[model samples]
Target: MPELIILLLFMVAAGIVAVEIKDLLASVIALGAVGFTVAIGFIVLQAPDLAIVQIVIEILAVVFFVAVILKTTHVDSTIGRPYKGADIFTFIIFGVFALAFLYVGVRFLLINSSAGFEIAQHYIKHGLTETGAVNRVAAVILDYRALDTLGEATVLFTAVIGVLAVLRLEGRKK
Candidate 1:
């Protein structure tokens, strides 16, 4: 329990630092740290497979963030943007939501098992047969949740394209 709290604190601190830091590289590193901390949390939860996947995804994401930062002229676009009262208001609203979410999450995590345990068992037992996939994870992600996977891929592609466009515009200005 102590370890979980420590890891959760580390993750939360990393997330806050990632968002609050001005340097793009530092923010990216903090974000990576957040992901690493989350992977540790997964390990603590006895989910080694998820931990491995999280670590791999975190590494790839960090690399992509670094590449985008290096390709762009400026490290941050908000360097010159003036802060407004709306920003503070947004932060206050975000804080309220974060607190509420944290409370609900803690309450849920304290449960010995979730309500979806039976559903998960059913999926584990029948996923491959139903989806015609050899692996349960593959069946779940590629067949049952194919649209979600596609949407995630599309979002990633869009982010890359947007970064490229911004960099191109920055280069043209020079």
Candidate 2:
């Protein structure tokens, strides 16, 4: 329990440092570290599926973003990008928002979500008869939530297309 708290604090600190850091490359590295920290926390919280997804997505996103930034880096860059007080205020406001979300999330973690547990139990008991599938999650996704799964599949297909577009050559077979 104490270890998880320390890890969570570390993750939050890393994320703040990442966002506030001036160098884009350093920010990406810190963000990747923070992602690993949160992924570990997710594993500890018993959602391995979500943890795996988070880790994969975080690694892919940070790598792609960093690559794009590096590719666009030029020594002859324009200067005099003025930073106003409003910019500082904007960051402060976002930090407060993050803190609020963290507080509510921790409260939810500590509380016994009986309703959710009960719902899972109910599904486990009743869904077997409704669907021939043994796995409740698969049954729910494929049978009870056909439309939702279809939407998610569509989104995944769109993401694949976007990635292909990003990596496209000049109509060359390579």
Candidate 3:
């Protein structure tokens, strides 16, 4: 439980730092830290498959983000300024929304988790018979949830293409 709490804290802190930091490189690093923390949390929840996927996806995302940042010109410094009234008001509104979201998410997660286990159990029992795959995970991903997997692959490919385009633009600019 303590480990979970620490992981949650790291996730939240990393998210806030990533958003608040002025430096692009530092923000990218913080985003990576957030991803690492989330992967660790998945591992802690006894989901090694999910942890592996999360880690791989996170690494790819971080690499893409860094590549894009590098392809652009960097601003040497940000001018210091006081927060505007609108900025403060927007922050407060978002803070309220965030708190409400957290409350609802926690409540939703705590309700009837056993139903989720039922689906997993059903898959484990019938996966091989239904899909004829030796490995249950493979059967699920390749057969049962093939479309979802395909969508994920598509998204990854799109991101890579975007990164390549940015790099190409940088080359052209040079």
Candidate 4:
């Protein structure tokens, strides 16, 4: 769709800005923008659950990045100079990560091909009756996948606690 294409373009531009910007804080903010854009794209694709998770993770990641940047020394003498070794190291690390992610994604799809469909069918057929809910979506979210929902809530809570801990200033007098 056109919206997805626009979102993809925005994400790419923000990613480039994040990587190329001289200001660390601005670069982090641009990276956060890319994450938020991905979340928006997830929503537009009708994956609200993924969108919610992405938004929460993006917020936590951005907060942590900002906190770390604030606490560390920002002076980089090698900004203008290109380090071939560092560049190659970074590229290799990123490539390995990307390959691992792709492998996991492919394995997940392959493993869940039929099982996922069966689970969906079960939920659709038995959701209201099993959960005694008026809405199918409510039944699926609140009853059928209650543990998954709880886990998501726990992750969000943990992320919030982490942000609070990172933001806490030590040795402040009352």
Clash statistics: count for each candidate: 0, 0, 0, 0
Candidate 2 backbone overlaps, count: 0
TM-score winner between 2 and 4, please give it: 2
In candidate 1, stretches whose alpha carbon ends up further than 4 angstroms from where it belongs are 19-24, 68-85, 97-114, 131-135, 160-174
Q: TM-scores, in order shown?
A: 0.63, 0.67, 0.71, 0.63
lDDT, residue 36, model 4: 92
The residue pairs that clash in candidate 3, if any, are none
lDDT of each: 0.86, 0.83, 0.85, 0.86
Candidate 2 per-residue C-alpha lDDT over 1-174 given as tens digits, one digit per residue, 9 for 90 to 100: 997999999998998877677677777888899988889999898877668889999889898878888897623233346778998999999999999999998789668677558877877898889888887767778988889999999999999999899889778678
Positional deviation of residue 65's Cα in model 4 after best superposition, in angstroms? 5.2
Off by over 4 Å in 2: 74-112, 127-136, 159-174
C-alpha lDDT of candidate 4 relative to the true structure? 0.86
List where candidate 3 sits over 4 angstroms from the true fold: 74-80, 84-102, 157-174
lDDT of 3 at 157: 100
How far out, in Å, is residue 44 in model 1?
2.5
Report the C-alpha displacement of residue 27, candidate 2, in angstroms.
0.7
Candidate 4 deviant stretches above 4 angstroms: 49-78, 84-87, 93-97, 100-104, 107-114, 133-141, 149-174
**Lowest lDDT block of 10, candidate 1:** 165-174
| Candidate 4 lDDT over residue span 19-131, tens digit each | 87778888899999999999999899987777887999899899988888889955545577766998899999999999999999999999989977898788778877788
